[model samples]
Target: MGRTNLYIHYDAVTNHVMTRAINFEIQDFPKHYFPQNIILAESTLDFGRFDPQTNFKLIRGASEIQVYFESAHKEKMRISNWIDFETLEDMHGLTAQEIAEILYLFHANKALKSAFFYKLQNNYVYLTLPNGLNKVYYRHVQHFYPRFQRAMVVHMSELLNESRSLFFMRKAKVQALPLEIAEQVAPIFVNGLKVNFQQAYVKGSRHFVPLDIVEDELTLLTLDQAPKNHIGFIIYDSNAEKWSLELTLDRD
Candidate 1:
């Protein structure tokens, strides 16, 4: 139930409907700090009769025909094998929209944030939604220096969208401890940590950072809260260090 990505492809000319879903579960801490399991489910529908909104059963039924794997290796023994495309097409008759109303519904239903359709016949491409993943990458992630036990619970879900998101420094001051303790820690910090946010990916309707941090930069790429139309912070990462602020993500 942690993170999931779903892909659907339907060809009007060939009358082919292909859907793929990847599900991930969080792994044990330290050894694997993120979700690593790749649960794959694929199905071929007839496409003509498939209703974009009312056919929840069709989509949910496909979940029953799924397979689980510890890794992405195709040769790995699956918990359950996927049905062949040819047999699947013979069993179901579902026509999908060229503009992909299903994708819009998918986004509306919170199944996914964005998706792309690349038609095989004319190479005609269509996307029902734009990406938050690409937008977070280019955002200016500044470097910072802070002493121990200074984590700050910053908020960012209110600003992200499909466009560019940027962050720059503002003035802030901290109280100092005794001179003896101050000597143990560097009193004056320097700039030029030479840090930037790495590439981000979409997990369901949320964006996430997929890298490690240095001294005290935001590590997790996640939103503070869920927003309407999947709109929120431009970047899911925080510039505040773990010691400087506690990461407060509004799950709502």
Candidate 2:
């Protein structure tokens, strides 16, 4: 995960919604009553719209259970947007104002320290812990789906390199670079391994970088297989001009 976000879960038994301020791993599930065989089912609308009437299935041992969501009786619900009472009544027992307050809490919890709020999906599966299994009672299964179209935003004017080492940059692209205008945006790194920008052509937008002025030194690494010792990144714009940096590490 690039930048981690807080995840929210709804507890039907308790009629409460809980959230995690950090990225949770597969191992963390056991304490929350998630079995090793519990496979997180990703929503069909993983990165798209959500249908309230979608059906989900859970397999426990030799038995299979089906899950469904009751319609909110409204058009749609969005993150951070004001929710009507009908939607809240359908999902949880909270009122519109209470739901709004909970939304505020989501942001507030994220703002604590350097934590950030991750994306929220309409579909989340709740799993109850078996008796004598672990400490917690249950957990909500959030998506493990990778996001493809992410907005890359950066505010730093200059890139920096190691204190005393050569910097290499790989996987660079430009939007519409021409021979004449290429010089204007050519000071940046390119897709292949190279110390300097000699010439660049636009095969796609991902391999593009607009380093009009050389202010800093950045070593772009090659994203090759087998732990090749190179870091890779692509620049895409949602025109939001805001960038987020997320760090994910494997845990034992």
CA deviation > 4 Å runs, candidate 2: 1-88, 95-103, 106-147, 150-230, 233-252
> Which stretch of 10 consecutive residues in model 2 shows the poorest summed lDDT?
146-155
- What's the lDDT for all of these models? 0.23, 0.23
TM-score of candidate 2 versus the correct structure, residues matched by position? 0.19
Instruction: Please provide TM-scores, in order, for all candidate models, with all chains considered together.
Output: 0.17, 0.19
Model 1 scores a C-alpha lDDT of 0.23
lDDT by residue (tens digit), candidate 1, 1-252: 132222222232332222222121112112311112211122234111333443322222222322222332344432221111222332234245523433343333221222222221111111122331110000011101111112111111211232333455333322322233222222111210111122334444344422122222222223222222121122233333111111124422
TM-score result, candidate 1: 0.17
lDDT at position 129, candidate 1: 28
Candidate 2 per-residue lDDT over residues 1-252, each given as its tens digit: 122222223333432233322222332322333231222223323222333332221222211111112111132322111111113124344345543443443433221221111222122223222221111112232221110011111111111111223455542222321223222212221222121111211233222222121122112211112222213222333233222221112211
The clash count of every prediction, one per candidate, is 24, 15
